[model samples]
Target: EDKLSQEEKQSRANHLMEVQEQISYDLNQEKIGKTFKVLIDKKEGGHFVGRTEFDSVEVDNEVLIDASKFYCRVGDFVQVKISEATEFDLYGEVV
Candidate 1:
């Protein structure tokens, strides 16, 4: 039989979390350099924030547009080219 100490258990759990996060980052990284339709749902400062058609685990992609260059309202759909991606969000440009 084998047993792990509390510290060892915590270390393994932390490592697992790191692996999960890296996997998530890698999966999201694949989305970069791609374009998708974004549905506007929020606005702040000079940016218009929105969600994409793709939704997984209740964590939808967030698209941001510069209000100075793009004009859109709530419920409007816009095409965006993915520029960056994070574990929880995405950044893009109007296309």
Candidate 2:
């Protein structure tokens, strides 16, 4: 088995955390009932944040992603999750 250094291990862990954040964000976005789009705002430390067409600066909801996969880009028109009255968005994994 290969041995990883403490720094290396921490790096891997941070990467994983980022992925989970992106996935969570995507999942939340999927809850939006209306069809809305979002742009990947920026990533800081390990968290990824974004904004949707329907989301206001402080009133509306925003998209948070774990960013696990490399398939998604900033401007991709993905089919997001839908809910009754909330605004959400997401990109379903391709089977």
Please, what is the whole-model Cα lDDT of each candidate in the order they appear? Answer: 0.82, 0.52
lDDT of 1: 0.82
lDDT of 2 by residue, 1-95 (tens): 76999899999999997887777566665565554456555654433445666566555455555556423455554444333222233332211
Reference-based lDDT, residue 36, model 2: 48
> How would you encode candidate 1's per-residue C-alpha lDDT over 50-72 as one tens digit per residue?
88888642465567777888788
Per-prediction backbone clash count: 0, 15
Poorest 10 consecutive residues by lDDT, candidate 2: 86-95
Q: Per-residue error at 22 for model 2, in Å?
A: 24
- Where model 1 places Cα greater than 4 Å from the true spot, the runs are 1-13, 56-58
The residue pairs that clash in candidate 1, if any, are: none
Rate residue 75 of model 2 by lDDT: 53
